[model samples]
Target: MSTAAHSLSSNPWKQGAKDALPLLGGYIPVAVSFGLFSVQAGFGVLETILVSAFIYAGASQFLFVAMVVSGAPVWLVIVMTLLINSRHLVYGPNIAPYLQKDVRWLPLMHLLTDQIFALTLTRMPHMTPSDRLRWYVSAGVIAWLSWILGTALGAIAGDELIERWPLISEVLPFALPALFLVMVLPRCTDRRWTITMVMATTTAMLLKLFGFPNIAIPAAAICGALAYYAIQVRPTDKEERS
Candidate 1:
């Protein structure tokens, strides 16, 4: 343990890793698939690993690759990417309480992602500042490592595995949705979040087949906002003739 961790401050990095391990176990297949697709799409091993490691955004990165293949304009891709990742802004405040002021904003910013954000938010309400940072960093690092390794392996051996297993062929492409379900369903507590999730699904389906808008990030934000609104509108029964 670092000397710094033993103080009143909880070690954010270590705890983050602990929470992140279980989640990373499930992320393996999806990460590899992404790596496979990225390579097939012409991204080299270095590019694939770097993006997974640094960008840390699977949906946006995948979409970026697809757009590149389609020969979309660079500006359009950039705009779309930003639009898709806009949800990050919301992650800051929700996690702010748990974060240590020890680091500047940039380092903290690096750790934001759907999985980490969701995990941190759930535990943030109860955490001391120290534990929050440690947990988030640890979780983020684990996610980062798994993603890099998974993609590297996927890109290298994607074809062989796909050819060998026919079931993967049949059950293919479900990981993203499955992951989404796992991450989002747990956070649903009110009608708004429910509606938001439904809308995002519908929108994603509608646009994905045709073109234009990307649905993943937008859908997440939509659901998140609606959930927030619904929870806020939570009604309380009035006192009777006090």
Candidate 2:
């Protein structure tokens, strides 16, 4: 291999970017949908773009636009958005141990998204500790840029495009969720993860049925974590008793 090719392959940042390439297919369409929806809900193109650039939370941004369009108060919007995104509280610590201790994490934490977290979780085990941060940052930047680009496109010309091809709108919303499933499903091969997945899914479904849809996702996540802990501890407790 050429020296330059070998160098690129060895660089954590480049490897991260390469890993993140598949995420574009997901991030772009969903971000475009967000931008288009925000504009249609009466936001300016710049405003829509800023939402993607700054807020950067996927589904929460859509929820924010919807709530604002419905004339919800500012405090409520902030609270609801935070609630929807509270899952990140779990995401951060789970990935933190894999990162180098000396690396500054506060600024980089903002780039943590569901997709990026999942990507890193699965791949970081294979990476050296020092490479983790660089790889994550590179992947995050790529995902972030794709989202912004998609938002800009949708904000600027989404209406015209949708009018020209109505079917695109229907399909865009599914892209991100599909991407997430593809990343997560492989991990379910582990029995603990499979049980956790089942528990989480059941909890979410039960909550939705009980008329508590807004809290379902976070609650499911909490339950799943607890369930996994219980499963993990049972083996230890049996060993102690023996």
The total number of steric clashes, by the backbone 3 Å criterion, in model 2 comes to 0
**Against the unseen true structure, what C-alpha lDDT does each candidate score?**
0.71, 0.87
Query: Over the stretch 1-242, how does candidate 1's per-residue lDDT look in tens digits?
Result: 44444432365565666678766655677777888899999989888888888777777888888998899999999888888887776666666766666756467677677777777766665666546655666677787788778788788887888888857645545665576578779766767667767765666676666764575557557565655655545454663433
What would you estimate as the lDDT of candidate 2? 0.87
In the range 1-242, model 2's lDDT, one tens digit per residue, is 45644454468888999989999999999998998999989999999999999999998898899999999999999999999788887887788778776647778887888889888787777766667778888999999999999999999989888999999989998899799879988989778999988998899889989998778878887888788778853366768899
For candidate 1, report its TM-score.
0.79
The 10-residue segment of model 1 with minimum total lDDT is: 1-10
- The alpha-carbon lDDT assigned to residue 147 of candidate 2 equals 96
Q: Could you tell me every candidate's TM-score relative to the true structure?
A: 0.79, 0.88
Q: Which prediction has the highest TM-score against the true structure?
A: 2
> Considering every candidate listed, which one attains the maximal lDDT?
2
Q: Model 1, which residues run further than 4 Å from truth? A: 1-14, 100-102, 169-172, 209-213, 223-227, 230-232, 235-242
